[model samples]
Target: MHIFLHQFADNAAFNLRRLLCAALLACSVMTGCARYVDKPIDAHASSLLAPLDPQQISADTKAHPSTLLPVLDIDPTGPWNDMQIGLIAVLTNPGLKAARAQGGIAEAQVFAAGLLPDLQIGISADHPDSVGVVNAYGISAGFDIAALLLHSATRAKAKAAAAEVQKNIAWQEWTVANQARLLARRLPFLQQQQALATDAENTAQNLLGLTTQNVDAGNAKLDDLALRRVALLDTTERAHTLARDIETTRLSLNQTLGATPEQRLPFAAKSIARDFSTLDANSLFETARSERLDLRALRDGYQSQQAETRHAILAQYPMPVLTLNRARDTTPIYSKGASVALTLPLWNRNRGAIAVAEATREQLRIEYESRLHETRAEIATQLTELQRIATQSELLRQQLQQMQPEIQALNNAVQRGDVALVTYETARAAHLDKQIAALALAQAAAEGEVTLELTVGVLLWQ
Candidate 1:
């Protein structure tokens, strides 16, 4: 009877061990089947520099696609303003897209950190050769309590990192948008300068022709005709250079919009904007400390480092594990109990990680301070530039206003033969030069205003 009982117990233990092994094997197989597989590489030229279609780019945005889609249908014969150009850049700039994707990565990490740690299941079996004894089998399951305790801070760090990414993305978008705005804002002024250069070239050519005729007829000095020809050449070169600059500026605008350089981008003909001379620099600096995205990102980074430091400190303590276990033996004995697990801190105490985390926090703190200092300086410099530009633009406007009628009178006198041809031509060229200078100053003032707004992390125009 004793031998039969022992056999029955051995059979029961063996069957239980087999059942547990089979279950574990099936779980492993299912998990292995669900593992990620890499896709085959298709080698080809990347699309980094590909011409972006406004409609397609709009549709690809994660949100607010409708805001940009309609911009494609807007009259291409535009009086398109800074806002329109900024919108296009915000929706299509590749730099901003890359920065935004980083935020997504951080978000995924945050989700991963919030998830519960996987449960660990373990099984073991032993067999004895004695006839009265039988196989022994044990099964246990547990989770790391240290991981559970560290979850809050780890998730906090990930969340902070995600916030930092978002701020960086916002700052990048602002950079792209500001570039497009400045280009669009100044393009019309460049166009006007080109047109004026053309006019000056045309006038010089006509004067050179007239002077050549007079010299051929022995009615004017050859030296005077030579001087006119030289002036014509100079003006022609200036016109060509200005034409090239205008074309380049347009292409730069296209690049900012993430479109082809050959694409014609229409912008408003007027280039002037409201004067920002009265904006208090100190006030803007204060606003920027709170509102600048880059600065905010630094603050977020510091907070994340703080959480990491906390997590590293916690890691210095030993990890505690609690497991529930079941065991059976061929002697007809069965038991169930809870087990505690812990690691001794005699060897590794996470001191290196803690020190690294502390050092990183300090680095972020200094970076934030350095950025704030630089931001203040930028605000001051841009404000001073705005004032100087306002004054310079005003003076140029006055000069232009005073010279226009004088140029007209000189033209009339030259046509009526009341003034010397050389004198009239010189005055006309000087007047055109003044007009170009005034337009350039106006553009400078407009751009200065935009830059000041950008520095302050505020949209003055909007």
Candidate 2:
């Protein structure tokens, strides 16, 4: 009886220790650890798997039935258009590749959340300093009662967080895809502008040469020669600007397509224009709510926050540490028993964590609401701007058509030397100005439609 009572004291002391220590000990024993391995970084940029050959790829896919493209449920590979470039961008963007790697961590967290808590087993042995005392041995096992009971909340939180990660990745892909499409759309417009600029520059240069000859021969006014020189300088400036624009846009396109800055992929096709008259504002708002990937990702984040709030509330409950102990002390004392340790702090029952979780949930809700509002406002603004551009472009084209007869007559008069050089120069400058303005408006309407597609989370053109 004395042996059992004395052994109880030793075993009780073991059970008094925090389950946290047992947990650490359990982790160290049940799992093996290793030194860190070296992972070398490759600083060199990697090229894409294949060069984008839109025409050839389209032909091959059709000619060979066995060569099928990936079915991502958003197939844009029908006509070798901008959308095809968008698909390639989503598949190959280097930044997106790095973003996708983060998903693995979320998956691992979910796996860990589902795992059961490990059992902690501890053992001790003692040798008597004096000759009379017998050898002593003690063994104890501990389990975390709270972790086992509250596992469902932890798993739900992890699963929701993983879902949020996946949604965020999808959102990134959507943004990258649209960026590639927009760059492709802009490329053709820049090319058209470049041609106009080059033609204007050449025209000015020729006119200035003729004016200089006429002025030296006393056949034209010196003031007329000065005006021609000014016109040449203006056209030259415009040409230089357009050249830079073309080069910069080309570089941007390469970047969007995940190619090196200098690697120009000669695959951009003319972007088909969308009729803004057919687009309904009400319908666009609905589409944005339902299909916007960022909104969906935000919803996932909010749900994860919901799980976190629940878990935080559950954490307030007392956690019981169950311990089973067996021991043999000096002088024939022995013990075998079990114990349940309830840890409850009256001073604070996880109020701080619960408060933090609630506040965070509210912040996320507000962020999502603000983002939705911005999406709706932006969609409406782009639609209105596109309508205005289409209207002005139509009017300008009609006016330019009406002005064509006079321009042709003026050209005929100049050829026969029946008009002042200044008269034709003025007419030419006005004509060029109107033509460039119309082209700019058309480009704006086309690119605005692309922006609208991004805002509404729908493909507006092929």
Candidate 3:
């Protein structure tokens, strides 16, 4: 009898140890299945600003159809138009690319939020020697119903945030497009201005040389020579200033097109004359209110915050988790049951979170209204400026028309030596300057038109 009792005790101890080991293994498997992945930083990520490859953009477009474009479909090479330049900037601008990545992150979070929670299992064992009980183990699977209840709201918020990102990107694209159009329109005038400045410099240099020769030959006074030299210096300085201005303008245009500074672009298109005769202020106001991308983003953000606030209010209640449990003991005693755990809301009722969410929602509401007012004001301002510029441009055009015949007569007389060459050159330079001013005004009006279209979220120019 004693030997049998001892063997029974030894077997019980061994079974207890096995049960403990099995419990530990189950826990380890449940928790350690997902390993950490090391994401090594790429050393070449700084090369994003390198010249864009059409093929790479195409491949990326295929990978992330929503985030990028097939630039290869467009003429990725030379002579990019306004829309093409905007597209290239959208595809290749580092800031916009990063914004696209951030939107993807929000989309991924929405996907994650919509997913059902993972099943949970619990294991327990009792030592027979200490507790005088048989070896036992229990497994439980459960999920948080509170999380399930909040899933819709969470997913809505995530999706709204993603929409906001897209709208923000559209606004950014509009800004780049406006800048590109303006600069491209201004390019010809800038080139013409530089050329005129160069001509003036050359004429002044020639006059200075003639005056110096006359002075040396005792045919002109020293005062005349001094005056000619001063004129040459002034014209040279003006030429140098204009050259710098042309270089700077080219650089800006290249940057807007996402090209290298040295890259030559086709800017031969004349200044665009946008007709505003059909534009009604009231209609434009309504359009801006309805279609503005930034305003749409603000609305999206407000919707997201509303959902978050709802979720926060709902979360103040008890978070109940339902568990399905199974247990087995060494003595063939098996059990199956269901249980529930509740998070009592006695201490923290989420009041602070609710307050914060409510305040944020109100703030967004006011912000939306404020932005609406600002949008209207901005559209009005642009319209007024465009009108003013249009009037000035028309008057300048008339002036140019009136001056052309006089200038031609002057040119003919100078060719026949009836008038001084210097006098004719001065008149020609004045006319060219007027032309440049008119072109600059047209470019400004074009930019205003772009801004108005961007505000209304449509291509009015087309």
Candidate 4:
């Protein structure tokens, strides 16, 4: 009975020890994990600049195809909507792709910069043992606290800069898409003008042929026939030039859409409805000032510089280093020691470095102010120009409407054989010129609207 009791006590003690060891091991693991608990400041700042996950980036890229184009649901102008044409440019433009990639790259840098520097290990050995000399082995491991703090600051700045750059990139891409859409809309009108010119030339040629037949029959003079032929040839040459100009315009539009130089896009033939009125310039200027990406980027840059300056000033203070050492000798000697060390700033007070940081910060401040001023001026200028163009366009439309009656009167006179061929031709040409001018005025008005809208951030490209 006694032996059994003793064995049982022994087993219980062993179990207690085992439990204690397990508890200790668990506590140690927890402590190691807790070492990574970020400070409140770091946590707050890091939260503000969380890196975009791979999945989120992929999703954004995928969503672009649907949203890149603008949808004009009310317009029944066939499959070639404004949105699809805009998408063709946004999806294919290499500049936009590169800008987005640059943003991603910047985001990666921010992630990298957030990480602390790695601890390094150094090892050395020496032996002077010709006849029983001593041998030594030394190892050292250390972490750079300054580097950690500086790197964190650098990462924060980089992140802010990257975000600003991304905004600019997005704005630029949207601007490019807007320009392409405007050009696409203009293509149909240009083609219409070419067709009109061709018809005028054909009409003139028919008149010349009639005059030549009259001369052969001795009913018309040779001089009159020659004059008619010269007029017809001139009209034909003008039509040819107009065709060439249309081709050039088409090539330009194709290039903007990322198509080959020789490639042509088959746009839907439609006329722009002239129902749009002038917008408030003052309101647009205010919106642009508030939303312009370049200005936002400049503001971000200024803030980042301020952070760097603070960090630089903070660096003047030296960090305390703690070192522990242990040594063992084969001759039975042993030693161990721990020491705290700090660098002295007796001669070099870091004044020069501080001055440099202050100067740089001032420069950044000036630059930011300058940028703000420039942005405001540009917005005002663009707004004024838009207003001017809108007014001119309205005037031209009025002129075209007033000229239509005279042109009709001349046409009726020619049909009734009450006017000479040249007089009728000249009147018709003048009317066509007025029509061309009206089309040009309409195009200019549309462009002005697009520019104003874009500047004010009413629309965005993918």
Q: Against the true structure, whose TM-score is highest?
A: 1
Provide the lDDT at 56 for model 1.
58
Local accuracy by lDDT, each model: 0.78, 0.76, 0.72, 0.63
TM-score, one value per model: 0.84, 0.83, 0.80, 0.71
In model 3, what is the error at residue 82, expressed in angstroms? 1.8
lDDT of 3 by residue, 9-90 (tens): 3464546456557656867886767679887677565574566565565455445443222233443344655555555556
Candidate 3, pairs of clashing residues = none
Off by over 4 Å in 1: 1-21, 25-79, 126-133, 206-234, 329-338
TM-score of 4: 0.71
Q: Put down candidate 2 lDDT per residue, 1-462, tens digits, no spaces.
A: 235434543453434244345546768797897779876575332434445545554454444322112332323344335666666676667787788798888999999999999887776656566766766767788999899887998888899889889878877877887777777777788778778877777777777887888888898998988988898899889888878988887788777766667655655557555678988788899998988878988898898899899988988888899999988887858788999998676968989999999999999999999998999889888899999888998899999998899998998998999997656766776787788777788778777877888888766554
Ranking by lDDT: 1, 2, 3, 4
Residue-wise lDDT of candidate 4 within 1-462, one digit each (tens)? 223322332342334344446545755785555356556756565543443233332344356552434532322233444445555566556577677788888788778778877654333333333544343333344666677657766777777777777777767777777777777666776777677777778767776887888798898899988887887887788779878877877777666665666654555534344333344556655666677666676677776676677677767777555555544332324455655566677766577777887898798778767866765666566667756666776787787788788778887988899977657766676677667666766666666556655666655222
Ranking by TM-score: 1, 2, 3, 4
Residue 76, candidate 1: Cα error in Å is 7.1
**What stretches of model 2 exceed 4 Å from their correct place?**
1-37, 43-80, 210-227, 413-426
Determine the backbone clash count of candidate 4: 1
Count of clashing pairs, candidate 2: 0
Enumerate residue pairs that collide in model 2: none
Tens-digit lDDT track of model 1 for 1-462: 234323544574455556566767768886755568777555333565667654554455434542322333333445567766776688777677777788889888989999989889876666776777767767778988998999999999999988998888888877777788888877888888889999999888878887888888898998998888898898899889878878888888887777777777557734446767668878899999988888998999899999999999998998899898877775848888998888887877898999899999998998899998999999999888878877887887888888888888988998999998767877888888888887787888778777876787767654
